[model samples]
Target: MRLIKLDATASTNTFLKELAKSGYLDDFTVVWAKNQTRGRGQMDGNWCTEPGKNLTFSVLKKMEGFQLNKHFELNMAVSLAVFRTLDLLKIPRITVKWPNDIMSGSHKICGILIENSIVGISLKSVIIGIGLNVNQSYFPGNPKASSLYNKTGILYDLEELLHSLMQNLEITLSMLQSGQEKVIHREYHSILFRKGVASTFKSGDGSTFNGIILGVGNEGKLRIRLEDDSLAEYDIKEITLLY
Candidate 1:
């Protein structure tokens, strides 16, 4: 595992993408930044953070012979790893929003973004980027964001937290490589947000419906039971949480 720390950068994910494209040797190569000038988020949103008060890092690994369709399980593995790391830190009020957001009491604590490359019939590599709010005293402008410090009332050493997160992530990836998809599936569902609760979801075409989350399907799609007793599957981009 090689840890590369940056005093300041545009974004750890961007840095890792460049390294991966350049064919960097990947076992456990991590790119981290204490401050990101242009941090990114899913759907072009900004990942706001206080410099030196959060954890922004990316993990790159070469995948061999893994099926491309199983990518969502990989996401679940990473998500559960983060959840476990926070749990070990004695933070018990965390849950994973389907597909990838870590939340505590309706406030988001972490966000994950994964990018992959495929070459012919083989999987080249995957870059898993994580942004975790660790010790920020206050979020700039959002009632929906919260940090570990705000929730726990204790500041955490960024390095120590990163180390623990990487360790857990490595373990989770190993489990996936060993064909333990059920393990990841079960654990993720156990900590899923709003399970069994009726909530509204917006489809890609902007259609909305109320349904109960029944857990995720084996293929990593969200399974929802609609009012008509019909089952619907939605990918991350195809659905938005109305709550």
Candidate 2:
């Protein structure tokens, strides 16, 4: 395990990807930036964070037994890891949105973006980018954003929180490496946000409709039961859950 702390950077994920390309990455290596200038979100969306007020980091995990087909299992494991860390902190109403967004009630406190390095039928490595709002109180235009201090009314030590998250991640990853696929699947859907509840979603063609989230597929696509009682599968870019 190696940790690199940066005062500022364009994006931690980008930084770590460069390291992997240089063949200098170690398993469980982490790159964290205090001020991420151009942080990323799902689908090329820009992640906006107040400098020095949040946790923006990327973890490089060498996938020893990771299969290309069971990619969503990795997502389920990582999402559960973050959920466990937040739940351990006594953060109320922790729920994982489909894929890997961690929500506190209705507001989002954390986001994860995974970049994988694939070689043939196996995944060589995976870069998990995490953006967690910690102490910042204001998100100028984003009303669905909140922080630990914003919700808990107490300031938190960023280093302490990051350490806790890493510990939880290790435990969850161990479960994954041990082939506990069923367990991970069950646990991930247990706290999934809006699961089994009717919700609005927007399609890639700019059409909106109501559907019930029916958990995720093995390949990470969101499965939804529409009004007609038919099942539909959508990849990350194909649909957006309208909160």
Candidate 3:
């Protein structure tokens, strides 16, 4: 549980990955940045957060018995950690927007990006980056982005929030080692945003359609029941849920 606090960094995920490559980092080593110059979300999306107003950090998890194909389980575990931590904070309407984004009602409050190091079909290690909105009252361009402060009208201590997140993350990540992947699957899907509800989606080909989010597939793909009543699976890049 080595923790490094940085005043500013390009990306904690990048920093931790480099440290891990040096072969000196222990499992659960964390790098936290006060100001992330180039923080990234899933699919290289820019995560814009005011300096010192949010939680931005990455964790290094050394894998022991995990395979390469079980990556989505990591997503589930991490998402549930943030989701449950927010729950402990009494944030209302907590739900995980698939692949891995934490949502409070209709607004996104957190984003997770996971990078894995693989060697011959085995996961050597995993780098998890998390950006959580804490005390930011406003978002300049992202209308659907909100923070714990905005949602609760109360300012929170960033260190306390980070502590809670780390504790929950440690417990959830252990589920992977304990063979509780099925428990993660069941709980993750239960509160999934828009599960079983008719929703609009845009395909990669620029076609708009309607569908219902059935659940997530074994490989972490979104399972949707299309308008034709056909069940289709899609990874993050192939589809976008239009609310």
Clashes of each: 0, 0, 0
What are the Cα lDDT values of the candidates?
0.89, 0.91, 0.90
**Model 3 whole-model lDDT (C-alpha atoms):** 0.90
Query: Compared with the true structure, what per-residue lDDT tens digits does model 1 show for residues 155-203?
Result: 9999999999999999999999998988888899999999999999998
Ranking by lDDT: 2, 3, 1
Off by over 4 Å in 1: none
Answer with 1 or 2, whichever has the higher TM-score.
2
Give each model a TM-score: 0.95, 0.96, 0.97
Which pairs of residues have clashing backbones in candidate 2? none
Q: What is every candidate's alpha-carbon RMSD to the true fold?
A: 1.4, 1.2, 1.0
Task: Show model 2 residue runs off by greater than 4 Å.
Answer: none
Best of the candidates, lDDT:
2
lDDT tens digits by residue: candidate 3, 33-141: 9999998877777877999888899999988658878988999999999998999889999999887889999999999999988888888888999999999997988
| Candidate 3 error regions (>4 Å) | none
- Top TM-score hit: 3
Worst 10 residues of 1 by lDDT: 18-27
lDDT of 2 at 84: 94
- What ordering of candidates by TM-score runs from best to worst? 3, 2, 1
